[model samples]
Every structure is written in structure tokens, then in C-alpha cells.
Target: MKAYFTYSCILLVFVLQACQSNRKTETKNGGIVKYKITGKVDFNDGMQVYLQNYDNELQQFQKTTVKDGEFILEGELVSDGIYNLIVKTDYKDKDTGKKSFRITYPVFLENNCDYEFKVQKYRDGNVIQAAEIITNSEASNNLFVFEKEVAKVKQTWDTRREALSNEAAQLKASLMTIGKGEDSKYNYAIDRMREAGKESQELAKKNPREEVSSLFVNKPEHRTSLITPYLFKYITINENNYARYWTVLDSLDASIQQHPLTIAAKAKVERVKNFYEQMPVFPSITPRNIKGDSLDISKFRDSKLLIIALWSSRDRFSKMDIPTLLNKEPQLKNLGVSVIYLSVEKKFEEWETGNKSLGLGLNSYLLNVTDKDFIVNNYNVSSFPTYIWVEPKSLKIKELRGGDPATPDFLSAIKKAL
Candidate 1:
């Protein structure tokens, strides 16, 4: 009886021990993973750390307190996937009293491992100092390891943009110096700046994959209407990004060009194309017009003189002059000249308003168009309110880009075209 009782006690103890071991294994794989951030930086205790998981959407996973130059970040690892951790040193500027920042290296968070982002701040006594970190990760995978990669690229872009802007401003200052006939160094500075701009552009082209504009646009959050225009602006500055800009524009245009009633994508395409026309050409088209009408540029073949006017509602000069030109419609008719208004307006309301205001002549037609392939490549309209005079008999382009007063050499080109 005593031996049987002892055997039962031993069996119960082994069962309990096995269950405890299973629980620890489960916790290690599927439960909360803890990370400790220790650094020797002289910042306030109020500093905080934020962690963002880079899935399809950047979901914030954890946050922790920065007390005594240390932080304990705890979060659940529901699955065996990689995550991105962002650590920001939150503080207020000493001089400005406004909110300031110092962020640490982004570390990749994987299951069952604690990663640290060791950062060293630049000695400069600025509100935000440059930082450097050495990590054992490749640049591509750094997306998971460091949130600062994006921020660092953004900072470098701003610095370069500011330098270019300052150089441009200095060029204007050079005119003043030259006017004074001062034997100044302004010309030399201007020459050096021009060379620097060329060098910068060459460098920008070499590493096309590293462009911030491309990275920013591809972000899932920015793949929408409101943000696309802003992205276009950034892409336009780097002419090497023409293909990147066109791909995005073409994709958006394709999605919405079918629904003429919905002006969101249509209008965006127009504005983007209009802006891009100033640069290299990448023309695309919507088969349908704003009035639910189909466009066939081939119909203009019979006219004796076809004046193609590339105008936009957003263009101040186009808005002002289109009305006057429409009022002179009778004069154009008597002279056997046909004027076609090519509107770049995106919204139906803006398009309607522009047409009604212009009151274009009997020989005129309003065709809503967008895409780089349509205007710059097909028609070669380089400037806004651009005028192209074609031989009515042959439909051959006789004059290209007759200027507006606001355009470079506007008066001279208009007189030549007329």
C-alpha cells in the first residue's frame, strides 16, 4: 500500500513538470518579447521611444519610458515576422522652447532576440544633431533594422535642396553686384554654382534607385489622390525621374480615365502632365473628353490654319487671355483661321467654367486632355498657353510653342507666330 502511494506521487510530479516546460516554450515563441535599450546620451528623462511594425501598413506595436537613459520596450509577437522599431528622443528646444527631437537607430525586432541601436550624436550643439550608427545589416534589409534610414534620406534631400536654392538666390544677387560694376567674386561664385548643379544632377542620375521621391510615392499610405500631386512636384525636380513619374501618372490615369464623371484622377493627370510639359515629354491620353465626347485629332485635317492652344484653368495667363481670344472669334473666322482650345483642367466644374468664360468662336472645340504622350510628344506644347500654328492645307506644324507674355521670350515668339 505504501509503495503504490509513492508511485502515484512520482507520476503526478512528472506530469506537472512537462506542462510547465510546454508553457515556457509557448511563451518564447508566441508571447511578449522584451527588449532593453541602453545608451549614454545626455538628454532629458521625458524622452520616449516609439516602435512601428512594417507590414503592409505601419502599425505601432510598442512604446516605453526613457528613464535614466534606458528603455524597456515590451510587445507581443503574434507571428514569426520581421518588425521595424523607431526610437525617438523627445524633448523641447532650449532656445526656441518648441518641441525638438533626437531619434535613435532603428533596430530589427525578430522573435526571441533583443536588438539594440547604438547611436552616437554629432558634437554640434544644435537642436537636432547628426548621428551615426554601425550595424551588421545590409542597406536593403535596413528598412527593418533602422527607421532612421528614411529620416536620414529625407534630411539629406532637404540639405541638398536648400543648397541648390541658396545657389539660385546667389545668382540673383550676382546681377546686383554686376550692376554696381564692382570687381566682385559674384561671377566666379555663380560659375562654380552652375558647375555644382550639373555635378549634383549627374550624381542624382547615377543612383536612380535611391531617390526619395520614388520611395515616398510607393508607400502604401500615399497611393491616393491628395498625396499624388505633392509626389509629382518632388519627382519633377529630378528630370532623371521622368520614367518614375510617368509610371505613377499612367497607372493613376488608367484607373480613372474610364470614369469621365469622376474628375479626381483625370484632373490630377492633367495638372501633372501640364507641369511635366515644362520638362521632358511623356504623353498619354484619355480617349473620352469631359463632355462625354470622344476626341479624334484627325478631324482638324481640313482646316486652312489650325491654331492649337494648350490652355489650363489653373494657369493664370490662360484664364485671363482665353476670354479675349474668344471675343475675337469673329476676326479669326473672317481670316479663315480655326482656333482649338486644348483644356488641361481636371475638374468638370473648372473645365465648364473655363469654356463658358472663354466663349470660344464657332470654329473652336474644347477637348479635355491629360498625359505626357498627348501634348509634349504628339503636339510638342512646351509652355503654358503655348500656341502652335499649323499649315491648314497639310496639317503640318509650322510654328511650335509661340509664347505667352508670362513665358520666356513671350512677346517675341507671339509676334513671329502671328
Candidate 2:
């Protein structure tokens, strides 16, 4: 009897150990996410909600159905990441008939946990009146709250901008006709615009160490103009600032750093490093002309200044920019600057056609390299219609412009380089 009792006790211990192992395995795999939408529910059963992995290169999407105003999503995330929950619905408008709309909510997700979201729809059926995360994770909740606050700040700035714009238009008309009475109003609008900029700067500085700070770093829409200067000032490559910037980046959730939205921020950090560490010389490569003759960029070292314009024919911005560069050539030539348009188009025929269509009078070359990564890495070219101004004697990149050439910012960079 004693032997049987001792064997039974040992078996029970083994069973408990097996259960603990299973639980650990499950935790290591992934977690569950439960989402519930409340308020006006006009949609039918089995309406689809998409879960998109936000940081992934493949942009993996998973779909679930809303049954009784709720859906569950389960997955294994190797690392914490930002995921998007998207819902599509259609409604009939009183005036315009039926229209379809999409609602997207971003959530920061981690493994081995469950997250719940409750979102409300407004009477308009198109607007999300409010959204709240019922999850226990404070970091995830804080990110969402911070995003909402940023949205509010942006809205206020936009309102002020519109008012100032309208007043300035009226003031311009007044100046053309009378030119005296509305000057104070115009000046007041200008002052308000400057005030709005300061407010944006202050909002960004509020949480420099948080993941939300990445939002302010390099917003593509305002990259070359509004945000770039702020980033340059804030993330300077000095010893103390560099260490602080790295610390902030390291502190972010691993997935956020890899997110598409944060690519600009990462690139900015790398740019700071490159400026301090990397060689200042441009790469030497000989590309072919329309006639298939090699035109060595190194040969242009004798010129006082060399302007290399990297563009693709398919890009809408390039269509506008190529002509602008051609038009400015005479002025550029007078200033001892020579312009070269290098086509990065995939096909030689396309390059030929685009070059002919542009009616380019300045030097032109077709990038003949089969390895696309070489050009991208060497030039640090992220987008098309990129202008790189080289000081030929040293091949040092004196100025780099990635935004619209028509902007005063780009013009100023060009002037400074000259």
C-alpha cells in the first residue's frame, strides 16, 4: 500500500510539470486579440475586419468576420509591432446616395497577451466618435492616447493655417488696389502662422523619448520644408545628443523601430552617423548615353560644379522637374554649374523615349548598372527626382534635394551650393 501511494504521488508531479511546459510553449508562440465595436450597427453578419501587420515588408493581412458586433484575431508575432484593424462598410447618404468608407485603427501589440478595443461610431456612420483600448498594457494604451492628442494638435494648427491663408488672400487683393488699410491684418496673420509653427515644435518636444516622437522626426509630406529643420535641430549629431537619440530609439518597442511609418526616423539617425563617419566622396560610375557611349561621371571633375539629377520617366514629379532643370540650365551654366540628368528607368527604350520627350539640351545618361541596390546605396537615393550637387574637385556632396524643385527650400539649397 505504501509503495502504491508513493508511485501515485510521483505520477502527479510529472503531470503538473507537463502542464507547466505546455503553458510556457503557448506563451512563447503568440497571444489573442479580441475586438468589440459598439454603437450604431447597421452592417450585416459576417462583415470582414482585416488585421494588417504594419511593419512587415510583405504587408501580411488576415481577415475575420464580425459576428454580433465582435471579432477575434489570433496570431504569433515574433516581436511587438503596430497592427492595423480595418473595417469597410457602406451607407446611403440622404443627398449623394450610397458610398463606401473604410475605418482604420492602429494598435500596438505584444505576444502572450490579450488586447480588447472598443470603438464607437458617430451618427454620420462614417466617423469614429471615440475609441478606447480596454487592455492592461500601459505602453500600448499610452501610444494610442498620444496619437489622439497629436491629431487634435494637428487639427488646431490646420484651422489656424486656413484662417491665415484666407486673410492673406484678402490682404493681397487689398494691397493690389488700395495698399494701406489691411497691412496690420496681414501682418497679424503672418505672426499667427509663426505661432502655429512654434506650437508644433513644442508639441514634438513634449515626449522626446516616447515612440510618438518618431512621428515628428521626418514626416514625408513636410520632409524638405517644415519638419526637416526641426529634426536637424533636435537630433543633432553631437556627442550628447547622439547618445540621447540612440537611447530614445533603443527604448522604443522593437517593432515600432522597424515600422514603415518610422523609416524616416531611422534614416535620419543613419544620416547623422554617415555625415560624421562616412567618406565625403561620391561613387565613380560610368553610365551610357542615348548612343550607348560611356559617360564617366569622374570625367566631370574638371567642371567647377556638377549637378546630377536622378529621375525616372514614370514619376509625375520628374516630368515637371526635368523641364525645370532644363530651363534653369542657362542660368546654371552662367554660374559655372553643369547639369546632368541620369535616367534610372528599368528599360533602355523607356529611357530613350523619356529623354527625347523631355527635349533635354543638357547632358543626359542612362544608368546601365544591373544591380539597382548599388546606385541606391551609393547615392543614398530614397525617392526619384533627387538632385545631388557635387563639388567636382573633391566629389563631395555639397547639396542634396529630394523634394519638389519648385519649392523655395530647394531653390535656396541650390543657391547656397552655388
Candidate 3:
């Protein structure tokens, strides 16, 4: 009997040990991110929090409802990447009834790690803006540090630019009043601007391996404009330059190099290469009209100057511009420009509905091409309601206009282009 009791106790101990071991393994292997928030704001049960992964074209978002100011998000990340936290709150206004406000924060997420964030909000009238991140992971700390440093540089640069602008303005005024040659003042301003730019470049070059370098490579503003000039100045495939420009990219971490921002940079480089190699002309496309008839864009090439409006049903600007386009049809025709509204709707039903409702008495066509990428890439259509003016004879793009076409400036630009 004594032997049997001892055996039973031993069996229970083994089972308990196995259960604890399994729990520990699951916690370690499973990519679970737990978050705790403590702040002055009132927390209600079931408040929602969202995590969005950064992407070049579209962001992937995940949501979880907060419970007692804490939430555990479960997902497996392939690699460490930047993520955004978004929280939205609705407040009932005494007069307006209800108003919604959003607060956002950027954080770095590593695979299989936990994070805690403290939300810091500052009052800006009725709306609240996220001011800072009090506590976060090491990666997040590094990213913020880089951002703060960049902000300081931008502030100093702006101050110097403003001072130069003031000096230039004064010089120009004196030249206008006192008659001629004050070109030296303008030259001095230009030289100062150049020097400031050099300083900024040197600052970035000083920390090429820092995680913040990813910001310079990936951030839209930096990659598109701020950093491109410096990069192009050094990068060459020729043997003489030693490919120093390419080495700047090579020095970055592999993860940063494979980031979406890096991908966008590569695309930009390819575009520049293609621009030099290919002729500047619009690609021929055959799409269907609302009445199910095929309309070849090439048919309009030699007939008259075509003003192609690329729009979608869901875009508010596109919907608003439809009426504007219809209103301006007579004027456009008078100027020898024919308008064609191309709907890039993904669904046939939505396109049909929009065509019937919004495109009444307009030359409207649905983008019926199967290869959507080809259309977007060839035309360089980044957003909806994009207007392109094509020359009648050469079939080359004369001008590209974005935003509301109904604006006076837009109409004036069209006339000027013609």
C-alpha cells in the first residue's frame, strides 16, 4: 500500500512538471506581444487598439480590444520591422452630437518579444495628439533617438534657410529699386544654402550604420527628395568612381535593405534608367465603355488632343471631378481637347453603377484590362483623379495634372499646356 501511494505521488509530480514545461515553451516560441498602458486618460473596457505594419503601397493592420488598459496581440513576424499603433476615440459634443479623434504612435517590433507603451497626449483644442513614448523596447528607443536628431538638424537647416531667404529678398528689392547688378547678394545666398546642405549630408554620413539610417532610406520624403540628390552624386556603375554610391546601400543591415522603403528606392532607380532608355510616349490600351463596346485609346491618338482622366468610384475627388469634367466638356472641345474618363474600378458592378450615375452624358470608359499593373506602371498613375494631356500627333504626354480639375488654376494650366 505504501509503495502504491509513493508511485501515485510521483506520477502526479511528473504530470505537473510536464504541464509547466509546455506552458513555458509555448510562451517562448509563440510570437506574442503583450502591451500595458498607464496614463491620465480614462480607460473603458473593450477600447480598441490597432497595429499596422508599414508597407510602401498599402499597410497591413491588426486590431485588438483593450481589456483593463492592457492587451495581448498574437502574431508571428517574419522579421523585425516598424509598426504603428493607432487608437481612436469618440466624444459626444454638446452641439455637434459626436466627434471622432485619432492618435498614432510609431514603434519598432521584434519577433517574439513583449513591449509596454505609455501614451502621452497633449491637448490641441478639442483634439488630442500623441506627444511621446515614455517606455519601449531598445529598438524603439534607437529609432526615436534618430528621429529626434533628424528633427534638430531640420530645425537648424530651416533657420539658416530662412535667414538666407531674407537676405536674398532684401537684395532683390535693392536691385529692383536702384537699377541693376546685385547678383552678388543672390550668389552669396546660394553659396550659403549649398554649405548648409553639405553640413546636413555630412551629418547623415557620419552614422551610416545606425538604425536611423533606415529612416533616410525608407521614409517617403527622404527617399524621394531629401536623400536622392546626395545618393546620385556618388553612385555610378563606372570603374572610375569605385561604386561609392552603391556601397552606401550595401552598408545598411540586410533587414533595412529588404525593407519596403528600400524596395521603393530600387524602383525609383529603375524608373530613372527606363526613362533614359525608352521613348516618352503613352502605351496603347483597349478598354470597354459603359455600353460594353471596345474603345481603343490608340484610335484617339491621331484624331485630337486627349485629356485622359484616370479615376475610381470610391475616390471622393474622382466623384466630385466627374461633374466638373462634364461641365467643362464644351470648353474642352472648343480647345480641340477631347476628354475621356477612365474608371479603374476593381469590380464590374461598382464601375457600372458609377458610370450610369456619375458619368451621364460623358465619354466614360472602364479599365477592362486584365493586367492592372501594366496599366498603372505604364501610365504612372499613382492616385485617382489624375489627368494627363496627350499630344494628338506624337501621342506623347504633354502635361500631367493631379487633384481637383474643377479648380481655376487647373483649367488655366490646361489652357497654358495646350
- C-alpha displacement of 11 in model 3, angstroms? 33
* Local accuracy of candidate 1 as per-residue lDDT tens digits, 140-222: 13343224444566567667867876777777677665755554566677677787676566545543324554565555433
Clashes of 3: 0
| Weakest ten-residue segment in model 2 by summed lDDT | 221-230
Per residue, candidate 3 scores C-alpha lDDT tens digits across 220-305 of 33321213222332232222222442444445443345444445445545544444346357556667787677766666655457
Each prediction's RMSD to truth: 15.3, 12.5, 16.5
Report model 3's TM-score to 2 decimal places: 0.37
lDDT of 3 at 91: 55
Top candidate on lDDT is 2
TM-score of each predicted structure versus truth: 0.33, 0.45, 0.37
lDDT of each: 0.51, 0.60, 0.58
Model 1, runs deviating above 4 Å? 1-47, 52-61, 67-69, 76-101, 104-114, 121-296, 299-358, 365-418
- What's the residue-level lDDT of 35 in candidate 3? 46
Model 1 is weakest, by summed lDDT over 10 consecutive residues, at: 253-262
1 against 3, candidate with superior TM-score: 3
Which candidate leads the pack in TM-score? 2
Per-candidate clashes come to 12, 0, 0
